[model samples]
Target: MAIARPVRALGLAAIMMWCFFLWTIFRPGAGIKGPGDSLANLERDPNLDPTGEPEGHLVHTSDAYLPDANPSARINATLLALVRNEELEGMLQSMRDLERTWNHKFNYPWTFFNDVPFTEEFKRKTQAVTKAKCNYELIPKEHWEVPSWINDDLYKESVKILEEHDIQYADKISYHQMCRWNSGLFYKHPALQNTQYYWRVEPKVHFFCDVDYDVFRYMHDNNKTYGFTINLYDAPYSVPSLWPETIKFLAQHSEYLHDNNARDWVTDKLRRPSHNDQASGYSTCHFWSNFEIGDMTFWRSQAYEDYFNHLDRAGGFFYERWGDAPVHSIALGLFEDSSRIHWFRDIGYQHIPFFNCPNSPKCHGCTTGRFTDGEAWLNMEDCRPNWFKYVGMG
Candidate 1:
């Protein structure tokens, strides 16, 4: 009887243990909740489906994982790059950084332009790396070729003199073509017509900050016409005739010059154009154009189109090796209010020796540090210290 009683107790204990095990495995509040229950219990997003299912998928709503608005519809913009087949690798590096920093979340489209057709390998490799929509187009030969208006005899003479003086890219005809295309022709490209805004990127450029917000949206909302990262003096030797021509244009078309402009930064105390040397003429301070975000409407406007055409007719792009930086600066100086031009101090950019690094720790992952007091270039006569002063950004 005693043995039987002990056996009975043992059996009851076993039963209780089994029941607990089953409860732990299958009960309503069991070991781990199912996906549906877990999702249902989560804090709901204001945008979440009231029925707790979004498009037949489990809704995993939480403060940490809130529903995200699609950035594409909000941004009327695209990333533009002018690259060659050989520049594919360098461009990919820049693209990868761009994705990591900003574009991955937004999935903005990218348009790559080349004077010649892109190679199959270049296309395949670039598309494989990014999920964003990628388009490649060949620039028309007419757009890239030297215009008939340019005097071939004079251009040859200028190139000879520049080459003798060892000026950078002076001997390369392609460089001049590139400068001219960027200065006036790129906005007219058929592929870019639909976009209201563009962010121009060059090969091997670095994106240092994690840009969480939409830059395009910001521009749209703020009514900003132009954005730039670095401001420096254009090589005076490269654009000696550019400012004088600009002054002449402004004088004749007084209506084009904005009443509120940044001309003081680009011009001298005499209210005359100057160079970095503080000469009686231009200070040559211009926004570096390699990294620019701008409203396309600004470029398509008559003011800019006329300005570019006037400059083109002058033959300085071919003769004096004029660059797009000074050309763009001159246009903005004349057409837009100084207040509309934005300095992207948060962005970190580097092109060889010069860098526009932000002081913000928000860019901790950047490869380079901030431009410091020790930088000799910052104090150089060519750097736009006065622009910094005028803009109250130094």
Candidate 2:
């Protein structure tokens, strides 16, 4: 029985009306919360006696957390970042949103960095909103400047290509400057220079979980290093031969390796097929270096620096548009190995085309036990170069 246009339209309208009624019931656009949350919140309310005491007062519906004090900051962390002077306000606003949401369930401080002075205004406004203890510092001059080994011709040529194509933000000179900063200087910031472990954060990123345990301390105690939020990029079109060059570099510079655990892990991973396990397979290499927590001394170690410098000298920073992904992945491969890299398999994260929620069906354990299934949460499982065992979530 084919329906006439009038009848069909009315039916759709009725269905849509029903949906709208449900939306009103569910309160759509009330922020990230969904109907399930209302029920959950209701269920939890009776458990919390708000007038009881400090602990009673501690209860809240939101998952966001804030720092308690300096010593408390040392216990757990919520390391945040700032690389550009221009984006300070936007970053602060994002922090404010996170602070507004997370209050004290996660009392972790923030660490801010810049290649220039953190203006007093930036500090004042940020503190007003975040309230959490915040530390601001300038990226030392050495850390901001381009390394001398960068090949001017190749670097310029690459930029010219991106610009000729009018690649997204490719023409923005400041972006390039910041990209360069990320490459050579960020990890070298003075405040973080001596710290054994730290988290790399940026303005405007979201924190949507109740994180009580000190992540850095967890790594420090367990002797794991190198955590990240997203997966590394893998576009062979970007640099076809660059991968081989990286392998060669690792082979030659394997001596200065620091973490025997990491080295063994990555070696085994390197031989494994990409997620698909195809014959002409690509490596299941992750390039999500946007957010990372790693040991300062390890990066500053002679061996690691030697490799970084060697690659920097090779002009990859400019030549191939070398991103932090390849740099971190290669370094992890050569230095720490699989056992050393800790993938925070359950941390909620978003980059593009994906939103990573740990407990969801798509997580570290999603695989038929293969890296291919990908991390629904953060996948720290031992990759093909499986040295780092993805310890089950905390």
Using alpha carbons, what is the TM-score of model 1? 0.77
In candidate 1, stretches whose alpha carbon ends up further than 4 angstroms from where it belongs are 1-72, 269-280, 365-370, 374-378, 381-384
Superposed model 2: Cα runs more than 4 Å off: 1-78, 97-107, 151-153, 162-173, 256-284, 360-394
Q: TM-score of every model?
A: 0.77, 0.63
Q: What's the lDDT for all of these models?
A: 0.72, 0.52
Clashing pairs in 1: 273-281, 273-282, 274-281, 274-282, 274-283, 275-282, 275-283, 276-283
Q: For candidate 1, lDDT tens digit of each residue in 1-394?
A: 3669889999999999999998878865343212222322323211111211111112122232222444224466889999999999899998988878777766678899999999999999888767778999999988999999999889899998777756699878999999999998998998887889999988888887666666776677777798887777665678767878887888788888887776666773321134434333677778889989998898899988888989999998999888888788878877888767876766667776666655455564544333323343334433444454454331
Model 2 collision count = 35
lDDT per residue as tens, model 2, 164-224: 5444554444555566566556666656644566666566555544343556656666666
